[model samples]
Target: MAHTINDLVGTDIEQYLDQHEHKSMLRFITCGSVDDGKSTLIGRLLYDSKLVFSDHLSALEQDSKTVGTQGGALDFALLVDGLAAEREQGITIDVAYRFFSTERRKFIVADTPGHEQYTRNMVTGASTADAAVILIDARKGVLTQTRRHSYLVSLLGIRNIVVAVNKLDLVDYSPEVFDTIERDYREFAAGIGIEDFTCIPMSALRGDNITESSPSTPWYTGPSLIEHLETIEIADELSGRPFRLPVQWVNRPNLDFRGFAGQIAGGSVRPGDRIRILPSGLESTVDRIVTADGDLAEAVAGQSVTISLTDEVDVSRGDVLAAADEPPGSADQFECHLIWMSDQPMLAGRPYLIKLGTRTATATAATPKYKINVNTLEHTATRTLALNEIGVCNLNLDRQIPFDPYTASRDMGGFILIDRFTNATVAAGMLHFALRRADNVHWQAVEVNKRARARTKAQHPAVLWFTGLSGAGKSTIANLVEKRLHEQGFHTYLLDGDNVRHGLNKDLGFTDSDRVENIRRIAEVTRLMADAGLIVLASFISPFRAERQLARELLDDGEFIEIHVDAPLSVAESRDPKGLYAKARRGDLVHFTGIDSPYEPPESPELRLDTGGAESAATLADRVVEHLRTLGLLTPPPAG
Candidate 1:
């Protein structure tokens, strides 16, 4: 019987597998601006290395003949660009991951998108990569996307870099051109804090200096691209750091083996070592270590293992187990390098979910302290982060979690921001440092309590919260309510949004982050006024439910009354008094609630009033006052 291809492959496969099982893998990414031949370079590497089989190569040749953009030449890019859109547009729209192996090492290659708008895709690819090959077109050297990609790889902490000065054949393989581009890139990279990189001259399409040193560039002496990669030693930098494992699952399947299972995020662990559960600050001794391949004596960073503690501690998923003496610090507030990913610009004060390791927390990103100009490497002060923008910002987590600086340990330090509503990944971040005040500051005990201050003024203090769409009569009703309170001779203060923004929050704008801060300041002032035994009336759109809930948190039970002044979108738009809704309709306003942005109404407000009807503002005020009196929170004026 004639041997089939599968039968021949089974017999011949082992010949290619000799010594391959022992080789450690290297994960690297190729990135550049659109049409820099990143996918082609990867394809050329696979071909030159003899990793592509005869049948696959034949199919690739046929694919190259069909949709290939290069005239009558095999489009090596076809190997990596699997999507039809990528081939049709001749541009990578998504990250295309591929795999191949060599005699010395196995490899995982990430072909990242290069467009400025797809910068977030580049970030996602580079996040796990150990090294980066940033390509520059010899015809057009050191463009903005080149600089942008260089900055991102640096930010992601990729130490190993190879600057492939590609398409040398197009520039007639000019040595001077390669040198100038290399020198310029070195200078730019230095400003971005990338201290070291190796530059090589190559034409990924023509296969110069890809696997073998190019004959075209006699002046260049650097090793070939594949030679550098094969010999490059990826340092196991985390081995020296403190051991940390974020418990992903509590394996109490049988109750007999209560092992905490997770991948070792940093350093090493073994039996008999003492470990602490973070945030809780509890300690226990390691009793046993288990793995699918039987019991393990020790496990290093990157290994997944199940560990049993001597004591039955209150360990749970999302908890970090760390070396007792060298555990990471915990803080509710963190300074992070944020890479915004969503079309909706990052709203600093609005609630987002940050999933770090196995732990997830409600977090608010402060308006970016500064935005990074990828082209210029300048730190520009900015209020919000749009899609693909990188910025430095402060993140306030709902609770403290174990963390190390992203520089020291990526596994323990990196996190992803998830949109609370859509559950889509909205951003990626790296923890830089914990805010010092979060750990160092202590609350001073006040001598006077709320009840004592209230008694002194002989009145009850409260915050009257009026929330609704803009032009929904929120401010009108709040003003009327405050007038009634003032008439009763009860000490009172009114905080109107426009009035407050002109002074206290003058630096803020209409961005979501700014709105959150605006409401936050108002809530704080309302609490302070109530503390002084004055009833406070606060009126704002307070569009987000999270921000409204945050205001309620600032007040004592029953002291905060959320009044949802309800009105339909049509009613509010029709009654646009300040012409703000008109501006929003004209597309002058972005993130305008009920228009472009979302408005989450209070699920169950303390008071719900329909203001779209002919109901008078005075009628609404009387209803509120009556409710306050019923709650024993109102006092009548003495006879004047």
Candidate 2:
């Protein structure tokens, strides 16, 4: 009997109830570059599973009436194309989630966007994925995007991979075509350290070799896509893994029940199991596991449940609960492989919002060790990263964070960076190793007293961060300020844009990641000077607000003063200090802030100086000196 909309809804509701009764489920993601047929493959998988209802079918049929390539035939891509823009673009822009069930297993599939620009979205979807399905368009074979997607999947440590080779019809279902692509990808996969790989061929549009056997490909012998998905053993892979559950919410209802609720990110948990809360490293035994349905004897990975611990220890959201036997290490510095996603480029020394598990922190890139050339898979000894570029970097967080190597565990290894002001996700990182372990072995402690050093040097160290448009008089005012401080018998160091480039930052270019590293190196140098009690005046077009804030955090609360050197675009262009504004106007620079890229001004600057309309460099310097006097850092010298 054909199931109607009403019957499907009733079955879904009953199944929802039944799911609460079960103790486990699996979550995975489908990822590839655009034109990989990810959406069509997912839609076909759901349709063949009989998970679609009459209403969904009718709606899709109705939606197809006004949309897509043809009339009458159902556009399966419409199933996952929930957004209007996605439909218009005919591409998956955001993460689309779908749920379905087979007789053997229940599954949640996150269909992630494939465009290189939306790599951050891919990270969000894959963050929770235990397995990943990477699609390859057989016609195009292994392209640059293919290698990039494979690198990211392996970097994120997705242990299981189903390499779905779509559009076999385009290649005449030639087994040789399939074998060549497979062998090429297999070699690429092995180089990146991915061991588990299953290659399958199918035409998502025609439904050939999707659910049932295809007689057209009698020469090819492999399980159908649906059959492989249904029978593949995932339980053993999860069972032996270490337990890690990041508490999302503390569910305390009416003062009667108090429990920590979160989805099990990895491993399993049972009643009376001993678990440790990370960052705190406090231990407790699980008292009971409760869901909305009832109590449970055990809860495994991917199950969302609330747990009560016997010893009421201090645990909250952002706290990770793990097996006491194998707790994640708390470290302040770690090495990572990052895919730069933002056009703004990652700034060195700039602070970014780091989200690991449920915890949020401020972190800075220590330095970029090297960038990998995607086409050749070779490490290019570069100092910075750009959009869609992959690099190995070291990060220094404000405090110690509990983390595991991505090779050891995906859940503990992956993290994302959010721009502080725009809140845009700028980068996705995979853990490689913690540098802190080696640091502790060869650690050195300086014996100089900071306060005494300031007194002896006759200056309080500071990082004067100047941000403005490209032609803004940031460098000009910074030079004058340094001159004034030098004459005032104060120990001062000036780090100007062009001067630093000629020396300390000579290797860096104007790309986003280069800018980030440029600011980072300058900030680190400023930090050292400040420790030695020298005022560090830094002048750069530090456009991003997040990067400025990161530089500020490296100093004392009042030590880092943001001086906004304000000037209208027209006025700055008239000055044309470096003739950069002309180049940016000429379309030579792709992401020049205030022209093509956005320059986020400081919302709450310590000082604002308009370098336009009769404001001289000396006057600006005097204004800065007055502000410093207000902070009790400087005074007039002997009333001369």
Candidate 2, residues 1-640, lDDT tens digits: the string is 1112444356687775565447245678888879788998889878877878899999988887777644658878899989999888889999999987665566789999888888778877877777888889999888777788778777776777889888898899999999999999888888888886889888887887787778878876888776676665664555578888888999888666788999887789999899999879999999999998999998998799999999878988888889999888788788898888888766676788899878888887755788997768798886557888889889878876778887666667888888877898889888888885645654467776566678776556677888898778888788888888888788888888778999988998876677777777777788888888878888888877666776787788788999999998888888886677788889976777778777778899999998876878789888998888788777322211
CA lDDT of each candidate?
0.86, 0.81
Q: Supply the TM-score for candidate 1.
A: 0.84
- Indicate the residue-level lDDT of 45 in model 2: 78
Question: TM-scores of all models?
Answer: 0.84, 0.78
Candidate 1 segments exceeding 4 Å error: 1-18, 53-55, 444-464, 476-513, 525-537, 552-563, 569-608, 614-640
- Residues 1-640, model 1: lDDT tens digits: 0111334356777754554567778999999888898999988877776767899889988888889988858888888888889888888989988887665677899999888888888998999999999999999999999998898898889999999999999989999998899899989999999999999999999999887777788888879887788887988887778999999999998957798999998899989999999989999999989998898889999899999999988998999999999989888999999988899888767778899999998898887899999988889999898998899999988788888899988887899999876899999999999998897876688988766767766678899889999888888888888888778777778888888878999988776677788887787788788887788888888888777877777678888999999999999899888888888889988778899877889889989999888888899889988898988887532322
lDDT of 2 at 514: 71
Q: Give the TM-score of candidate 2.
A: 0.78
The top-ranked prediction according to TM-score is 1
